[model samples]
Target: MAERTRPRPAADGAARNWLGLPAALAFIALVLLVDLAAAAHAVLIGFLALAPLLAAAVDTPRRTAAAAATATLAAVVAGLPSQTLGSLDHLLRVAVVIAVSIAAMYVARARTGREERIRRMTEIVRVTQRAILRDVPERVGGVTLRARYVSAYQEAGVGGDLYEVVPGPDRLRIIIGDVCGKGLPAVQLAAAVIGAFRQSAIVRTRLEEVAADLDALVAREPASTHGVTFVTAVLLEIRGPRLRVMSCGHPRPLLCRAGGSLVPLGTGTPKRPLGLGGDRGRPDTHRWDPGDRLLLYTDGMIEARDAAGRFFPVQRLARALSADSPEEALDAVWEAVRRHAGGPPRDDVALLLLQRLTPEPDTGGCGGPCPG
Candidate 1:
């Protein structure tokens, strides 16, 4: 049987009105109880009764004006039965009070409008940022890709950390990297790295060649307005059931097998950072299998330190990757890292997971084998 679902609640304005009606009525009743023979005391009480009306202004200006007007009328009626001044004096007093209330309402309304505009502009900026560094889709060269990026600062659209996947004629090319700095300067460097990777990944046959291309680009571009910046990166290529990785001073990636074993790839020792014109090293390649997973990351992940000043160990991260799904595994790893950092990260973090898809039986036809 199909299950029925409940309708969603109405908009905030409608809900506010529904909840505020009773309070508005109660305010009017309380104002009526005040005796106006003592004009100073009565006027004080009457003005206090109108406080709810000012709060109501947050939702609708018309409602706020109506509430203010009602309160003023109640004040006048309350004064009528008492031994107050002549009718004209009473009317003048009411008019003056109402005028003040209206002015206050206008000020509140203007402030509210300004706040809304700022909120909307912030949302637009956030949307634009997401479009710029959009998420990479799964399934590049028959491998499943799962990735996550988190900014250390709240409401940040993009940060220094970056990764990209490119499917080329020869192999599936991937790059996981981090810029040296933060803010707009870091973002610009990250963009340059991504641009260089995309263009070179398709043309260059070797991972080292791609790294050389990126290094050259960074070295030639003008220093950011803030200062010169650089990035650490790892370039990867997946072909058939094998993976080739070239590291450029970035953290080494980990390999997890279908049977729950993990292997740390690349030389564990540190290398010269990219963009420094240092001597380059040869690329390293390894065999992979169906159901195996590859984990790529920026240093921010493993370098995260707990309150006890201990860094998050790579071995512990690998064990956490033995989850049912790539997303789950990545989430677990991030949560653990966040805890170790004692809270949010001080720098941007990026994590990329690639799962080798099981190959389907060949339905032979035509041409030579694919590139690489």
Candidate 2:
């Protein structure tokens, strides 16, 4: 769902700029000191040329130009006391420093333009992805819900994993899936799958019809996007105290009951991933009681590997999610996953946590459990 996001503070950019100029000045000073101290033994003033180049990396073009000018002046000044200022060696050093500084300024300008373009593109992609997979509400049809999307591609924050929570008249419909490829094509396919699911989940009374619609949609995608593309999905319909799950070659969701009991739901044989044009098996029925938590996630959570190549064991570490609320629980789970993998996930991860709230007695809350 739409997680809270904060823009990068201006101070961050200011700090970067601050660092570059001082660093360049420090390098120039160091080179001057070395050149003056070692003048009797060796020539080292040429090293001043690196000051502007270093500034180009993190400073603006104007600052870079300043650094270049400073470096050129330092080169000439350092050569003066040694009586070598008019020599060909010192003249060549000054010329090379000027040329290098000019190049560094141009490089800094080009790099700045490219960085701005990337920032704009990144913002656009983030908005588009958020539109496709809109945020899930905190409560839907009496169920508390929390969702998260993590992309392995940190720069883009876009991937093929998708999920949606649709509130029905008396139930909550949910779908989670993973598209088969990467890049923009995979993101497109993921959007398509979510679009199809959002449309069908409301009208189709049965989960099978919704699954069928998604399968057909993926199968019809053009081959040009990829040789062949398919999506592994799971369709869920939560009605009252019962949960119906249908797996399309996706991972089985974990159910965490009160007092720290965890069970894998949807044990039935699964069908082919969507787009393969195969039969989607019947939905598996499970009892979902009050205060129970259901964890739905893409395979990325389980397949995450650590430095020693050991796959993350979600089932074992799931007890960490015993928090009082789904959001807190999810944060704990996400942290555990990152710790297990020793870094950010290597694949797209989509997580949806559903909790059946327990009503307080005599407060107009439903005393009995919700219908199945």
Candidate 3:
């Protein structure tokens, strides 16, 4: 079944687009009436040139042209009683109106063309994001999984952050990483890392080998323009009751136990971030007990700052995950993070919540009761 994601409202609504034309027409009417009322002494008709320019900034090119025509006609009408048609001064005012309208039309065309190109590129970014950062399934290897990716760039819905879940016969391997930068190059590097993770996870039996493969891929990938490309990642392999973790210069995963204890897993100093040519060494082992929840996230979560420049409190995560379901838990944390930052995160954030479900007694199936 498809995940029921919320629909986002349009950034620029249709009603907003319609405002520019009506506003331009109203301005033209006001200026025409004032020019007539001034008894031809104060020539405000030339000021009608502002109408089309205003429309060109916010309205469609066709509407901008209409605004230009309306302004020129208004100028002609205002010039009638004063110069009485065909007069040099009256013709000069009309000529000025015409000249300004032509310039406005040119501006409208150029602005409209640039907007169209941006629209096309935004569509391309959406398609690429969908392909590269496909949604994670609801469940994987007997564990309920909930994932969310938030990009700082609203135009490009996805950025340098990435996460993936690769399921084996008895185990589940997961990776969450962040590339060094942003934009298309960052997205390309993120895609490469995810690709390498999926491939290495399948072939390599050990988590260290998988991390090594990713390190090699990021180190040699030509997409790195700065040449010092690095990716901070956390790799996990969960089989039976054992959970092994290897952190490469990434935040430690938080484990919320059934008894309400929060533990930060892994030990020793974290290995250097991938692309630094350092050995990944070995993964640390931990217990994956039933009714336990594991929270894996990027640095964006803890690094998010508020108006006072204070970082988000990491301890609040355990309370946030106390919701009834994994999905709701993720939503709670996401909302809290946004609230703490006072807006969207300044950097890309990727979160994965994995809950170990207690097995059913009757059929011994993974579909078991969830802990609060």
Candidate 4:
């Protein structure tokens, strides 16, 4: 059963505990030797109690208490060789060692508790964020669709990156973007941008209007007061075989034609990222034939770094996709990124791919495919 097969890492902790008491006693013995050699009258080497204090950080409280007891007993025995056990001074040295160990144990426990609470909170936040960024659909406006997201750290499973697709009988609209920062505030801002897109995508006649509306929504939010952070966004609208794109300080998307040629799209001069008041530019249009694919992504995908500090080559990889469908292409791209990074990412990545599917057979009187 899966339950029986799960690994238990805690089993190793007990093995490590075996090393704790002896190490503490050895440290105390060394200090006693130094005291004897120097012939100091005062317990000048009592500072060596720090060894047990450090042990408290890794060992359980019970184990740490045992180490502290061993250390304190050793210190007392060492002092008895030089001073009488009945002397009040000898008791003071022993108490100092015990006090240091107890304080360390309590502080360590408090810190561990705080860390656990934070980890649990992070998990709850990641779950909510995933629900917000979940996939839109498998097919949209005669196109097969795929989307993927990767968070920068495994501890914090999601960040400011966002993506969405709204399918309609006559038009398909998609948005991919990255907020200026991470944390709950950035996620709230990303959600606001998606909400604006959902509300205006169908009603607005032009991509320019949608962009302006999104900018207005972000500009009016409380998060906009800082003025430094902005959302880099690209909006795409496709009506039948015609595709239009409007970029707002976001990276340009790539288009893979049906004929096996790949090219990055051009949306003219870049505008300011959303949140700063600026003019919204017009959208560039393209003709999308069946079998053509469009790739939309945030900077996180292109900016991922390897151990050598080189950035991932998004365009070069775009030209390399030879998958049979959009889903397979997205998987290949994700796998390539994982291999390049070699571990958890340093930034959140959001990707969306749309491939136009072949049209249905024509049953018109003209014996040809119907025009949009």
Candidate that scores best on TM-score: 2
lDDT scores in order: 0.71, 0.83, 0.82, 0.73
Q: Arrange candidates, best TM-score first.
A: 2, 3, 4, 1
List of clashing residue pairs for candidate 1? none
Cα lDDT of model 2 by residue, 192-269, tens digit: 888888889999989988888888888889942454788998889977777888889899988888768888887647
Which residue segments of model 2 deviate by more than 4 Å?
A: 4-15, 40-42, 224-227, 359-372
Q: How should the candidates be ordered by lDDT, best one leading?
A: 2, 3, 4, 1
Per-residue lDDT tens digits for candidate 4, residues 124-163, read 8766766677656887547788777776754566678888
How high is the lDDT of residue 277 in model 2?
74
For model 2, state the Cα shift of residue 178 in Å: 0.3
Off by over 4 Å in 3: 1-9, 36-42, 80-86, 223-227, 259-261, 360-372
User: Could you tell me how far off, in angstroms, the CA of residue 368 lies in candidate 3 after the best superposition?
Assistant: 22
Relative to the true structure, candidate 1 has a C-alpha RMSD (angstroms) of 7.6
* Tens-digit lDDT string for candidate 3 (1-372): 112122253536455466678889999998877777878642777888899998888777899999999999888877666755666767787788889989999998899899789778877887788788777878875688888877777765768888988898867899999888778778899999998888889999888999989989898888544676789999999876577899999999998887667888888899899888777677887776778899999999999999999998988777888778888888889999999999878888889998989652332223222111
- lDDT of residue 337 for candidate 2: 90
lDDT measured at residue 18 in model 3 versus the true structure, 0 to 100: 65
**Predicted candidate 1 versus true structure: per-residue lDDT over 1-372, tens digit per residue:** 101112233665566666554456566675555544344534544454464454455545556666666766766775556645346666666776577668756855776688678667656655644644556777766688887777665454467788888887647898999888887767777888887888899998878888889988777767733336677888888876667777888888898888888887775454556677676677676767778888998988887888888888878766678888887888788888887888866767788998887863333322222223
Of 2 and 3, which scores higher on lDDT?
2
